[model samples]
Target: MHIDLIRTSSKSLPHQISETLSQRISSGLLQQGVRLPSVRSLATALRVSQVTVSKAYDVLEKRGLIYCRQGKGCFVADPEHTRRQEDGRWQDVYDDYLPRAQLWRNFDYSEVKYPFHIAAIHSELLPLKNIGDSFASLVTQQPELMATYGNFQGDLELRGIMRDHLKTRGIALASSDVMITSGTQQGIDLVARTFVGPGDTVYLEAPSYTGAIDVFAGRGAEMIFVPTDSEGMRVDILTRMCDQRPPKLIYTIPTFQNPSGVTMSIAKRQRLLELARSYRCLIVEDDPFSDLYFHAPPPPTIKSMDSEGHVVYMKSFSKVIAPGCRIACVAAGGNILSRLIAAKSASDLGSPLLTQRAVLPFIAGKYETYAAQLRVTLRGRMEKAAKLLKLYAPPGVKYILPEGGLNLWLELPASPDIGKLHELAEQESISFLPGDVCYSAETPSRHIRLCYSQMNETDMEEGLRLFLRLLGRFLQMGS
Candidate 1:
């Protein structure tokens, strides 16, 4: 078989040749078990040196795209054997994981540019020097940590630091009550795995964090979405739902909710905690954005008010600090914390020690000072984004100026089709999370979530302009 090599490009000839052959194998043009041209023959055919052809073959072999045999030419690797499951038999074994897998598959937009779907803090705002210095100190002063596994409950010093941190927020918990997780996502998964199962009911805010929704749904928990107003999840509605059928877990983002960006009122927070206690249901309070408030600090967390062990509070540092560290703490009483710790141990042995060590000093030392400054920067961005939205949003579109958090939820007019709008936005290189994915159940939604914190000031404004232009065009077409 003749293999084409591009020698004109700036890339090394061997690299170009290997990439071409790899593509052929991946595309199935080079069938499994088919022997490729010999190194000498291909070198002569392409008028290149044998060393170059051999180097290309070596590249392909190392990548597992091809395998070399003694006294034989290289052959394409069998795609079936490389796949996780050769046939469909493994489907029965991992049937439970497919729903969440499919959810993630559908949510992927990695290829999109200027994406507003992500809720992460912009990288530019992170304290790079502080994190780098902490990491460097850990490596230089305590190199032994590199070879050892950390405590399954997490580093003792970090837990102590997190305990002190929680006290300032009104949640009193001992160091033992706090368990370290990879992040809020893992904390949610651990709780879901330990407490929920098929046919168990899990209540969540109507438009909640998609990650939480996926985790609970994957565990086969029956999801019941509680509607939200400007004040966050309606505790009254939740109370009625609990009376009808007590849920196993009430998963909520009470402070600066994921898509809605609404903080629960203090009265509602108290009522929700009381309802959870009376119903004997556990509340998984995901509080990632509470520290990001623009005005005065939001109300006391429900976990703070829980004298009974009814609330599992997960506080993520990824929002304010570097996400690369993947450090977060879960605070729950002994009974639940034990189960969560067990689940965490079963998941990954423990989170990386180096990362925990790297983040500990930052959390203990400069975190409060950094967060105070970050809040101001994020508030400014939020205000600027809101002003742009107000000026450029399509006529009749409605949105509430969020008091805090990185996202703004937009409610489109009845005329413009959401699916069409998404398509048009993509054509303009703009992207945002469609509201339907945030819901536990599929339904028509005239809403979208725009995350203002993922992009810089310039990109944020430009993207919003593109998005509004498309939205206006779609509205006009529908009119």
Candidate 2:
């Protein structure tokens, strides 16, 4: 209705009108299924003849830019032409989903020499044989489990086993308090779906897990970033923010947080629980890497301190057992666990019975022995990686040697020309996770996460040799 028409242009009124509307449709200004103004109304608004507007509408209809509904008005059409047409037409109609971890979603790293971007344990260290044997044993003993639908909440035996495991983490839960999910990613998504909504406030660490950031963003939650330090999320800053606008949820990874590899201290954990109690907001504790500690346990999990059922605790076995099994569980005290069960039923009838059963033996008893060996393997890799950094890494690169966790967080020079560094690394088949994706909002990225657990001694050394050289050059260029 608000299109501009030049009176003196040589182009006919109808030709200009159609071109303008077509361009508008081609761009996203007028999205699909939007109703256009009545031809008479548009004609009157432009002070033009109705015939001109009619001609424009006719052209739009023939080209399939829009469809006319009986007794209604012309509406923009779905982007079907994108499939038939080239010239970047697909971009115009694509869903434009942005809440994904860009590294995994966009990159093609199949041929990379050094894949430090990945955060999973090396396949060599995973308990493939144990899990496979467990699978065979389960199928032989319980064929009905493989054939029939599982309880959407999860396997009963698995839940009981997980309940015992939680006792070690200082989280005591009833049988009904625990619900199984595919992994922490799905668990966070379920919690977000159940609690967060548009305009709902959620507090998160500044450099939180990329998956958690994507999940909350996809739910349209207003995320408030609480800064973190060597001890983990700064409860002091969070306290001020909470005083102003109390959030509906506070999500934290108290033990060996991803990307930063920092752990929250016990005092702050207690204070965080206190704040949650004061404000009556739900707290979601994501604890995937807690069992991967090198020297000593980080601290008691925030969930363990919550006696009031204010916390929802998530723990994943993927890091130790196998990511393919996709095993994780959630423990919540209140009726919220029931609501999560409902959401789980809607997600997938249940997680694959095969996978749940496959991980049962490991989680039940075999985990302790396998975990000890896995930790030693990872600690060796971490030590080798640390030595390589000490020998080859340039002066400006700063990092904290974490006690445990897969990633090594590096803080490059403030004027880090990360784009150039990334390009150079890519040329040599070295890949890492840029720190920007770990954040909820745009921040100056002078950080990168390198996973030492993914590569062995020889390969890790060679990859770091090339990477440090390129990084040195990039940092020097910035200076």
Candidate 3:
């Protein structure tokens, strides 16, 4: 119950006192349910004002380390309860549905101040005020939207807006051809659930979006990994695979393809569509990063080349727009679009009407301007990151300066231990997505994906510098 007070430091008396109690609770020195000394007594003993001790206890209670029972004073919270509250036992139920090892797990680095692993736009770059105003307008204009379940196909107005948006990208689609999704991930899941099932064959780029891989694998689909090169997925190899074992679905992120950041050539896009039609395979073209190009626009999407209704196109706004909005749309013709709408109804009735309406104004009005500005900002970040890499990257490190995307894929020296490097990088407060996770198969890779968009210029430089130093040390030791 005794707290040793430091009387001579610049830190306020309350923070130091709170830190001491936090340490005790965390270390188990103060047992759960152990009653703490009364504020009056502790204040008297420490020779500090009662208010300072009261503030300290307030900090502890706020942090869930302690709780006060009015007249009974404060007691240390049950560590078990605190642990449960912080991280629940959801895995107990989840394990029944999927093997714990097979489930897609992403490292949470929210506590890490400098994070390069996240493939998300920094919040500072988001058009928050504009979106906030849109939300406010929705509430003022159509208050009933809050109480109504939207159309199973999504908000009609939002879909119409997306229809026009897709048209600008050379993807001609009507409102009937479009289905709103929570994001590209959900769009992928909806497609997988509608078309793919156990024993169904699915083809994905060797290094593809992990979320899509999880969705297809979760549905018990047998995945065939198609190798990709600087020109994007090797359509020649895919053609060979199609001849051998025609897949039910071919999932691709052809525009600035994920992790590798390579765009498919126009010829490949046309040939891919032709192959899909010939093989009677459905192509799920996930196009999230096409609008993020720095130089000339990427080739026409495979979906754009798909005139035979062979392609299901998904475009996500969560990356370029606000992530919280969770707005994305899928474009398909015929029964595919119809089945996706049915799946959408089964998933959650529909995405939130409120979110759909909130983003409508932005799409209808300032979207083009916002996207232009974002491209400029992101291009600058990409350039800065490229310079840092050139200056600080270790010898034998190789990478393709992405034509336009948020990520840079780095290939370490031959046979380097990525796991050890990851451990050391984490110890230094840096994080990245290892290349193995990007693959559909379980295999070793000496590559890592570094997302530069999430970090500001300063943190990005510092994190890369630290990573380079650690990488060099690790390589030297191996040599």
Candidate 4:
């Protein structure tokens, strides 16, 4: 706990001490509930007066970094919990872009040996040959199409291709019902903008996808959290809540849900559709990783079960096929489809014509072969990673094993400092998505999301072993 301080600097002794301590606490170097050295002890160790230490501790206490326990000692406090107590809570973690981007972007990939925070297939695994060849063929065949602004409702032929793609997943929507967007996030953004407004209620699962959270919250929607389980979003709870306070729209990632990797039961999905119908609300089903299943396929999508236009189905291909293309499709009928198309046109006119044209042929022909091979590779990585963590993780640390999806969701034993864990992992060139950012409510979260497909087998094994050791040490510190 030794801090280097300048004796002759312009900064006051208390300022220097408080600054150092605050940085440590905020960065999670000193995790929540860990006892801090007493005023006298720290003063003596740093060769400072007791009054100076007291002033520094006072500053920290004001910032909700530490709390004094009369007879016991001073301990690190959870800032999020303190904020909640003061009614100064962040309604949504991704209310701002900087905070959201800071959490997920600008990583030094070269230095990071194991970037488990990344939620896409490894570059080596992407269908590079198929993509390049398809793009080249499309560009050569239709040089003028590349210069054109493509359809706002997405390419008709591509929509037809996507319609067939959805058929493989048990969803049967007409090509005319589909609209293309840059990616699934944009699809969600369009939905939020088209329908949701300030103070409008939107129901999303607890610990849901951060991107969707950002979109809905950015639109000023009053986010209501629906708790989830092994079978995914608790439909019973949703049903109970709907009678009390009905949301304008419901957002759900039913299959291989982001961060949690859980799938909603078929019964639950059907019930959800029924509930939404009864309430006269909308359901936005964001289906990202449903196709990445390990063994048995997940239940038919909510959109598939809906005979009426109650569900809006969105799917992304960027994560698995080719990230740079940023291709995704949304299927909605009637005025809802018209509104999204209008929103999409206002946003960017349309997605790149080249990408739409390029992906259509590849998706029509080679995508199944590519996805089949990818599922096998991803499953192997997932199984081995799961085995390693289950064997070595500290007691009380639990995880959900998914039938499909790239992420491995972790539940830590006690609340270990996630900020501190991130800082420590950075030093080891490892990364994982801290579960705090995934929440709509800013609460103390003891969870993490690790993507197994981010690295090769060698890096995955070595990095996960190192990550486990870090967890063991962190838990031991809590003890």
| Candidate 2 structure quality by residue, lDDT tens digits, 1-479 | 55545464445778767755664554345667766788888888889988989998998898777888778878888755222234665554343333333434324576898988878887878889988898888789988776888889888999999999988778888778899898888999999998887557889998888788778766756677899999999999999998877879999988888889999999999999999999998999999888888998789988888888899999998756898778899999768898998998999888888788888887888898888877788888889889989988899789999888898999987766565677789899999888867775534467898998777667887898889888887777777
In model 3, where do residues sit more than 4 Å from their true spots? 1-95, 99-104
Q: Pick the candidate with the highest TM-score.
A: 2
**Runs of candidate 1 exceeding 4 Å displacement:** 1-96, 101-107
TM-score of each: 0.79, 0.81, 0.79, 0.80
The residue-level lDDT of candidate 2 at 40 comes to: 84
Poorest lDDT segment (10 consecutive residues) of candidate 4 = 92-101
Q: Mind giving the per-residue lDDT tens digits that candidate 1 earns over 112-213?
A: 777898887888999877888988988999999899998999999899999999999999989999999999989999998999986687899988887887
Q: Which ten residues in a row have the lowest lDDT in candidate 2?
A: 97-106
lDDT comparing candidate 2 with the true structure = 0.81
Q: Candidate 2 — which pairs collide?
A: none
Error of 3 at 5 (Å): 63
lDDT per model vs. reference? 0.81, 0.81, 0.81, 0.82
Q: The CA-based lDDT of model 4 is what? A: 0.82
Question: For candidate 4, what is the TM-score?
Answer: 0.80
lDDT of 3 by residue, 1-479 (tens): 44444454334779767865664454345657666788988888778999999999998998677998878778888745333332543432221222112123344666665688878888888888888987898889989989999899989989999999888878888899998899988999899999997657789997888788767756756678899888988999999987777779999999888888988898888888888888888999999898888888888888777788999999998778898888899999999899899999999999999999888888889888988888898899988888888888889999999888799999988887786787788788888887866764434678898998887778887887788778888999998
